[model samples]
Target: MFRKLIYIVISALLLFSCGGNGDGGKTKLVFKVGKVAGQSGYLAQIVEEFENENPGVDVVLEILPSITDQQHQFYITSLEGGSSDFDVFALDVIWVPEFALAGWLESLEGKFTDEQLANFLPGPLKADTYNGELYAVPWYVDGGVLYYREDLLQKYNVKPPDTFAGLKQAARKIMKGEDNSKLAGFIWQGKQYEGLVCSALEFIEGNCAGILDDGGNPVINSERAIEALAFMKQLIDDGIAPEYVTTTDEEATRHSFGNGNVIFMRNWPYAYNIFNTEGSKVKDKVAVKTMPHFEGCESASTLGGWQLGINKFSKHKDWAWKFIEFMSRYETQKKMALNVGLKPSRKDVYSDEDLVKQQPFMAELLNTLLQAVPRPVSPYYPQISLVLQAKFSEVLSGSSSAEQALNEAQTRLTEIINRRK
Candidate 1:
């Protein structure tokens, strides 16, 4: 009798542990999602809120490496291997086309309503779509903004520049008036990496036109493109920009600007809060605006941000969509914006009275974001970017002239585009 009673108790415990719902007789669903460590805090909060609102589900947050490249590689390897471990993926803005073309992501066209689709900014929405099909939903948006030293501008009696020529003039004047050897006129991402591609796109687009025509043909070897790249080389050649800029990435430029050593910087919105926070040398002395353009051209910013997509191999795609929808709502976006300095992808959120009052810079940021342009939306984008990056870096390092580099880039890109076809 004692052995029988023990067996019965063990059996009861096993039954209880098997996820049985006592009241409704339905087992709870467990959904797994992944994000980098930088976004994990707000994501955890969203997950907790989601779990509270839906008592029948559990969200498992799989934290990935903070480094963007490492995280990207991990996702590519896992997804390519047909792993179903993660139901949803937080993807880089540029990865949508690659993943969608590879069929690693589910087409999200019908998952979103027309009204919902209209809320997102056009540039970000453009990034989430591939070949006329939606593969992801924009979670946040980013664009390059010009950050300047307000106090220095005032001291030098200079106004903010609207044109690239004016910016160069202002930077030179400030550097001279300050008379500090430690000061540099401007800094930006010039390193020979993916960042160089983004920087080059801004310059190429701002000077005249983007690298590709509307028909998706390679037009990177145009005179306007040569002039654009020449301007980049001229900055380094003319001593207006430091020689070390060739090695500088976003964080390096940020540190130089934050330490009050740079008069101007081109960086994303993420740098705004850090520049104004306590302990920064330029705290309260920094101002941001749209990037400068050529005299006759309108300013163009490179669109960048992150989006969420459901993995094609996931079994819990329905619940995965639910989590994505929850996180993409207006309230959720506003909350994340206010708490974590994330730029919202929605046009409506930019006009929120309370958010505007709290984040005054969002007013300028919204203007910049509206004018932002996405990089080429193609699965061959990585190879294309590599070609441009290599050629542009050559120009900056003085190993190749602007025209020579762009011509080479054009040839390489055509080969890549045609080979993929």
Candidate 2:
């Protein structure tokens, strides 16, 4: 009995010495990533899985509020302060340049070798790279798309609209019906947020040299840009869309849609799950497609979504990279598509048999993502985004004519660039 007891005691001591109760244990790396606020439920599930796979890491995830612009602003202040508390940040595609230029991110060199680069969707990966150096990895991709009420369009005996004008006409008939005045012809993000920039891109693709030209100069006040904003004004003035849309952002517009109060809306695929979930009024009846364009305008879709990054101050860089590699693998990626509605970055994942069964829209969604254009990638991008949002809101609200708004915005953009220079 004594010999047995001694053996047990020795085993206990050895185990205790190894790690018990956090005594001289393995290095504990506290990593942080951003999540959309109120969406912690969804992201927490992913984080829990990650923590389980990486037993040596203790992760702390922070979910900022819905406004992505504010989250980026938080990054600017927090990272600029040199706080090493966060080892990873959820980055937006355009913020790659700012973070990289500020030297706030790790080299990522030798971490994600060229072979692994083949896993990412080309557009998103390109968005995260700058001057031949990659600073982040594409987390998920998003593209602008139109959501329409299938039943209402069917009632009108009309096919899905092929052009913007056709869409306007379809919305008018639906709203005029006795049971549908409460329904808007069109609803979208017009509030002064990053979404405004996203929502407006469908109107002016291949024009105005984009928000920032190839050299990162603001092209907002160009003739083409004025025409684009004017189209928005025309929509409201002509009664195709209600005037109050000026105050609507993502949540407001989404709320209106969820209540079955809008004939059409433009939003990212993230809302697909929310709109089709059990309680939504339009469940199983809403149809989604790429944002339609003006008759002569080129079809355009704005790109937005999260990017994965490694913190420069992390001591366990190699281990953290391994986790990233695992998360980005083809098997893991398809699982993410099934688990969360996140569109994948890999080409093959789009065609996975399970994904096709889950979302017949996957093929169409992938096509849009492949062709979508990334917003300007630059250290001064946040400023340019603000300029576009302000002018766009003013023009849509009738407070400023499209011409005047663009003219003023152009001057401000030029001044900002000159100052930076």
**Number of the predicted model whose lDDT against the real structure is largest:** 1
Query: Judged by lDDT against the true structure, how good is candidate 1?
Result: 0.86
Question: For residues 1-421, could you state the per-residue lDDT of candidate 1 as single tens digits?
Answer: 9999999999999999764444463223344344432566877897789888877677777776656677788889988899887787788888899999889999999888898798999998998889899999998898988999989999989999999899999999988887899899988899999888888888889988778888888999999989999998999898899999899998899988888889989988888888887788888899999999997998989998889899999888888888889889999999888888889999999989889988898889999999999999878888888888889999999999999999998998889888856
RMSD of 2: 6.2
Single out the weakest 10-residue window by summed lDDT for candidate 1.
Answer: 25-34
RMSD for each of the candidates: 4.4, 6.2
* Predictions in order: lDDT: 0.86, 0.77
- lDDT of model 1 at residue 140? 89
For residues 179-213, what per-residue lDDT tens digits would candidate 2 score against the true structure? 55576888789888878888887676734336777
| Candidate 2 residue-wise lDDT at 150 | 89
Give, for candidate 2, the lowest lDDT window spanning 10 residues.
20-29
